[model samples]
Target: MEMIYRPLLPATQYCPCNWQSDSTSLHSLPQSKHASSFLRTLIAPYAPLWVNSTPATTDNSSDDLECPQANINYRSAFEQQKREAAKKMDATTLMMSLYVPKGRWQWTYQVPFENRPEEDPVTSNRIWSLSVRTARIYNESITYICKLYPREVQWEGFFSEVKLHKTQLRPLHGASTPALIGIQSNITGIQLAYDIPHHSFWIQASPDMPDILKRRCLDAYHQLHAQGVLHGNVDLANILIGGDGRVQIINFHKSRSTKNDPKVHLGLATPQDFNMEMREVHYKLNYLGAREKERAVWENRRNSRQTPSRRTTRRRDKDPYAIPMEPPTDPVRWLIPDNWKPKRFIVPGQSREQFEYHLRQFLLDLEKSKIHSPSEGDKSQGPNRRPPGDRSPPPTRCDLGKRKRGEVDSEDDDDDDDDDDDDDNSSSKRVRFLAQTNHDDGSKGKVRSPPPPGVKRQVPRISREYQNFGESPKTFAIPFISS
Candidate 1:
């Protein structure tokens, strides 16, 4: 056989070596600094030539020359490992970021079965199952007890039932059934998420509960029945007893509309039909021997109320307006203070000027009462003075217009009927009343001239018919002012 020479492996491959024998040597190496450091750590356990104290020879001289070349090989392998690790870390981070974030109104989660409580009744149920998960929403941490269905058809049916409950029954008041938030499905099964109520089931019999609780439960059943929902599963587990002693019926998956037959039956009847059975049970528990007598009496009374005699019908027809009438008085009149007098009404034949004078006097009296004190003498005596007697002539047409415009600056001796300059406050009040009454006249009441600055123009108080009553040929009776 021909002798063949096999090139020996480099020492750096089998044993650790200071690839950077000198600072200049390391800088001159083609491999990167990171690759060099990685290769050092990977071969840390291998004994170096310096540690072994091996003698230098011709065979070892070849190993020294090959060290840089071996380092390049090691560096490539190290870089490949780092690249794979970084790719795996980036993939894991991206998966974690894809999870659904929390929300305001509602939230959901895919929880594992291992998360459920070991002793929960849901874990023991055979026909139906549930998985528990926590959801933070609406500023509350709600523990969602999601119902799990095995088959696709079963999940579809449950979803339909919940949708019906949400749309048809949720809008009705006192329908205290737990609301469905959303549905989730996966390889394991389908889950129906509902807002979990923090309450235990109302397990006690109707007779065992207090009269109030019994009535409330009965009322809830009635309401559910009236809404056409038949709580097909009304067992102790389905009835929830709230912390505040409220009773809520839940688990509508087995429930049915009055118009449809239930998919599953647990011997529970529709609310309307169930009421009669409940009544009998209640009578048997509490009224014992008086059931028949009480039923007979109730039937007799109901029949009597339902059937009206011919004579009674005739009487009702003869007096169709027999409803009781309330007295004509202001409902809020009693809320007024006792010291406040009723508003003064105009006398039957009172003239417009007389009514105005009386109104001014009333307002002045109110002002005096507000400022009056035992120590203060009457300050009613001033430049704006009213005549002591009613003998003073009524206001003329020109004086009324001048007063309305706030042009009466001084006491006019020429016109005895003119009011004092201080009467401007009273004139403004009269103008407000006129504006209110004349509002229906539209453009007819619009002011042609603007009043002077700081002066409010008087609005006509009388209606269109009364605007030119003095010029009309016919005499019209003044409208009555009722108390």
Candidate 2:
């Protein structure tokens, strides 16, 4: 593909020099020799586009001039050299050059032009580019992600990121972030070494993701933070996970190093202030899990309500004249009887099993009382003494007669009512026992009414004075004795 090179730096800052046949090739330049010549062979096929600072001879005649005047003259000469070099970068060379700075400097290796530079679709950073092809360096094919700063952009971000990649991220290479391959002037190359197809963490994020995968992604960030590098943007889109289960962080254009406190660049915050990146990641994961779980519960309830009964479906299919009925919108309200009320006696803050266990124990106690027979000593102790299970004793004829005579006197009626209250309490206990028994039997219990007039009994009554005054009256005992 045809490559276009826009001048990234002004002529004063960077001077582009054409490759000369008489001059030394970039590969033959005196620099640190690699253990292997693979890098030299890689760049051998591509023509050299630019060269670093060309050495100049100082004229001894200018040494006698004033210090300020001589410095001005030297600066003017350097600028003149840059302008001459800029004129050499003709239209033909501009169309064929890459976006790298105007220098033939060698880094870890050399990259030959495979395709033109394209804007990186994945990066959140404003300044980013992707080479349209991969480079097989040292027998390993790598996806080359490039950081590009054109002429209009500031060079601080590009230089700082390169410093971070070459220094802070060196130890974490191939583990957390991508390894820095090399840089050419305005463009930097890093190795995205994953073998399998990958996607951003945002695309595959789910509450249902395996615990191992979540932990792995989180651990990758911890590893990065340990290197004293803070990823200012801890977004899901910046994290990459491969199909082969590898997790790696990317887009370090916004990252900062706590260890290096150089002059602040590009209005970026300090590393200490941005330490919350790890915390943000953790909270986001928890939010996703909770949100998904709640959604699942709601969906389950809706599906259960929407599913029609098989019997109803069959009936509708068989009846030709049957009218189609829509499902109830509020299923709970439709399915429950109108008279059904919430249970007032249900103990709050208890699980279903706990409530059921306590209720069962109460019923068991009632059953034990019902099965107990009266002891011989208790039965023979006194005529007034009844069985152990009985609470109120049957009143004698004499007591009933005295109570009835007492009711004749209006002042004495209160005393009679008080005495009857003890018997009423005993009757209530008997009713509760029957209710418990009925509960165990799965039937409704009935409250027994007072017997007919032929039976001897003391029945509760309301006083006439209290009733006439329109106030709640006390219970009066009625005498009914039969021999």
Model 2 per-residue lDDT tens digits across residues 1-483: 323332222212222333232332243432345522322222223222222355698776756765563335778899998987776444224422322222211222333434232222333234445321333343433334544445454544555665676567767766776555454432243222221122111122322344344555677887887777887766554555442345677666667776664653523445444444543554444422433333444466667744333464322123221112222122221122323211111211233333333333333443453345223333222222343455454677977885564422223358778567646554554554333434333555465645788997765564333433434465645453443
Model 2, stretches more than 4 Å misplaced?
A: 1-111, 116-120, 124-126, 129-132, 135-142, 185-208, 264-275, 287-483
Model 1 worst lDDT window (10 residues): 320-329
Error of 1 at 39 (Å): 74
- Per-candidate Cα RMSD to the true structure, in Å, reads 34.9, 31.6
lDDT of each: 0.42, 0.43
| Candidate 1 residue pairs in backbone clash | 434-461
For residues 300-339, what per-residue lDDT tens digits would candidate 1 score against the true structure?
5656633222354322123211111111122222122333
Alpha carbon deviation, residue 234, candidate 2 (Å): 0.9
- Candidate 1, superposed: residue stretches over 4 Å from native: 1-119, 122-125, 130-141, 152-160, 172-175, 199-207, 259-483
Best candidate (score: TM-score): 2
